[model samples]
Target: MPEKTIAEFSVKYVQVMDEKGIADAKLMPRLSDKQIIEMYRLMVLAKAFDDKALKLQRQGKIGTYASHRGQEACQIGGVYALGKNDWLFPAFRENAAFIALGFPMHLLYAYWGGDERGAKIPKEFNALPTSIPVGTQLLHAVGTAWAMKLKKKKSATIVFFGDGATSEGDFHEAMNFAGVFKTPTVFLCQNNQYAISVPRSQQTAAETIAQKAIAYGFEGIQVDGNDVFSVYRAASEALKKASMGNGPTLIECFTYRLSDHTTADDAKRYRTEKEVLEWKKKDPIERLRKHLEGKKIWSSRKEKELIDWANEKVEKAVKEFEAMPAPVPDDMFQYLFAAMPRRLREQRDYLEKYVNELRREKNG
Candidate 1:
C-alpha cells in the first residue's frame, strides 16, 4: 500500500458580533431582544462587582482577589448557556459566571475576605464551590459527568479554567478520561492571552489550545470571547450535545485579562500598555452595549439607569459583607476534619490560652 496522508484537523473560529457591535445576521444566535438586553445587564453587573471588589481589597476589606474585568462575555455567556439541572465546576476567577448563575454577591465578598463559610455553596445552584487549585476542578467536572452518564441523566457538566491550567497534567488526564469514556463534559478554556505572568505562546507549542482536544478524539472550537452571542451559541450547542450523549467538546474562548492577575500581582511588569490599550477596544461589556445601541434598544438613559442600579446592588452587597461577623479563629482548623487531630487540639489549646492571657492583661 502507498504511504497515505493521515487524517487532518482544522479548528473553527466563531465571531457573531464585531468590536464595533456590528453583528453578522447569519451567525447570530436565536436570542430575543429581551434576552440580549438581559445578557448585557448581567455583564455590566459583573463588571461593577469586579470594580468594587478591587477597591475593597485595596482598602483591606478583602484578601487577595482575582479580577474578571475583560472576560465578562466569556464568563456570563458560558454560565447563561447552562440549564438549572446541569452541574458546573469553576476554577477561581469566575466572579461573572457566579453572578450569572445567581450566586449571592455578599457571599462572594465574604469568600474573598478569607471566610471559608462563604464557599458553602447554596443548595439551589447545581454548582461546586470555586476550586482554587489550578486545573484540579477538571477532574471533578469529569467525575460528575461520568456519574450522570451512569445514572443515564440528560444533563452535562461544564468546567471553566484559564489557559495556564491547560499546562497542568490534570487537564490532559481529564481530557483523556472524558474522551475514552464518552462522558457528557464540556471543557471551557478562557484563553485570556496570558496565564498570570506567563504568555500562552510560551506555555505550549500547539497553535491553539482547542487543537489539543483533537488529540483526545473530540471536536474543538475557538470563539471570540468578547462576543456574547458567539460564546453563548457555542456553549449552548456543546451543552445540548453533551446532554444528548454525544461525548465532550472543548471550547477555547480567546479573551484578554484587562486587569492584573490578582490583587497581589501587577500585570504591568510583564505586559505593555499598548497591548492593554488594544484589548480595551475589545471590552466585552462595551461591545455588547454597542450591539444593543445599534439595535436602538439601548440609550444613554438606559445605560445610566443600569449603572445606578448595578452600583446600588453592589453597594448593598458591600455593606452586607462588611457587616458579616468576624470569622472564628477555630474555623481556620476545625472545619478541615471531622475530629480535630492531636496536633490541631494542641494548637487550639495554645491559641485559647494566649487569647485568655491577652484578655487578662487588657483588663489589668
Candidate 2:
C-alpha cells in the first residue's frame, strides 16, 4: 500500500465522520444517543416537509416554495449548536433551520401560503421573520448582537445566508461592523456551489469565502458543510467563543444545492442532471446513516419509524394550512401601518366597494 499523505494547509476545525463512513473518534463532537437520534429524525422530517411543499406548490395549494433538500445537515447542525437564548436571523431559504429552532410547521406553511400570521413567530423564540431580500438579514444579526453587548447580555447571534449573498453590500457592511465592534456573531455561509443559476466561480474570485473574515480581524474556518458533525462542532465552538467576548467568527460551510432554487426556478436551464447525480454520492444524511449503522445505533426498523412519523406530521400540517380561511383583501393594507392613513383608508374602501359590486353583478 502507498503511504498516506496529508495536505499541508488543511485546517479542519472539526469533523466527526468522513463521507466514506469513516469516523474520527478524537474529533467527533460529544452527543448523547438521544440527541443523535433527534438530529437524524429532524433531518428526515425537514426533507419530507420540503418534498411536500414542492408538491403543494405544484398543486396550487401554496405560493412559490424554496426547497431545502440537500441542505438539511447544514441547517440542523448550525441551529442545534445554538443555546436556547441565542437569536437566529435567517434568510428566506431557512425553513429547516426555523423548524429546528421550534418555529411551528403550520405557521411556516401558512407563511408560504400567503398568510401574514405565519410571520409572527412567538416573541419568546428569538427567531426573526424570514427575510426575502437576500443578504439584508446579515445586518439584522449584527444589530441584534450589538444590542446584546450594550445590554450586557450573554448571547450570540447566528445569521444564515447563501454563497451568492456574500457579494451583497450588506454582507460586507455586517461583517465589518461585527469585527470592529467585536460583536458576538457567527456569519455562517452555506456555499452550496450555486446562487440561483450563478455558479460559485462566478460569485467570487476568492479561493475560500471563510478567509474573508481574516481580512476583517476575526478568525475564519472552513468545514464540510454536509457533515453534521463538522457543522455542529464548528458552530458550537464559535458560539462559545462569542459568548466569552472573544469576538465574532466566520464559518463557510461547503455544501451543495440539490434542488432548484425554488418553485419559481428551473435549475435544468442552467445545470445538468449529471451534476446533481454526482452530488448524491456525498449525501449528508446517507453518510451519517452509514456511520450510525456501523456503530449499531441505526437499523431498518428505526428508519421506517422516523419516516412514517415525519410523513404523518407533514400531512397534518398540510391539512391545517389548507383549512385556513382565505385572507381578506383588507388584511394587506391593515398591517402596513399601525393606524391606516386617511388616504389609504379611502383607497381600501373604494377597492372593497368595487370588489363587492363585481361580486353582486356576477351573482345576479
Q: Which candidate is the best by TM-score?
A: 1
Give lDDT tens digits, candidate 2, residues 1-364. 8888642333345556777765577878899978977888888888888989998889998899988888888899999999977899999889999878877788899888888878878877888888899999999999999998888888899999999999999999999999999999999999999999999999999888888887788888988888988899999999989978889999999889898999999999999899999888888888878877887999999899889999999999888887888877776577657889999999999989998999999999
Prediction 1 global C-alpha lDDT: 0.93
lDDT scores for all predictions?
A: 0.93, 0.88
The all-Cα superposition gives candidate 1 an RMSD in Å to the true structure of 1.9
lDDT of 2: 0.88
Compose the digit string of candidate 1's lDDT tens values, residues 288-363: 8988888899999999999999999999999988888888766667556788899999999999899889989999
Query: Which clashing pairs does model 1 show?
Result: none
* Residue-level lDDT for 316 in candidate 2: 92
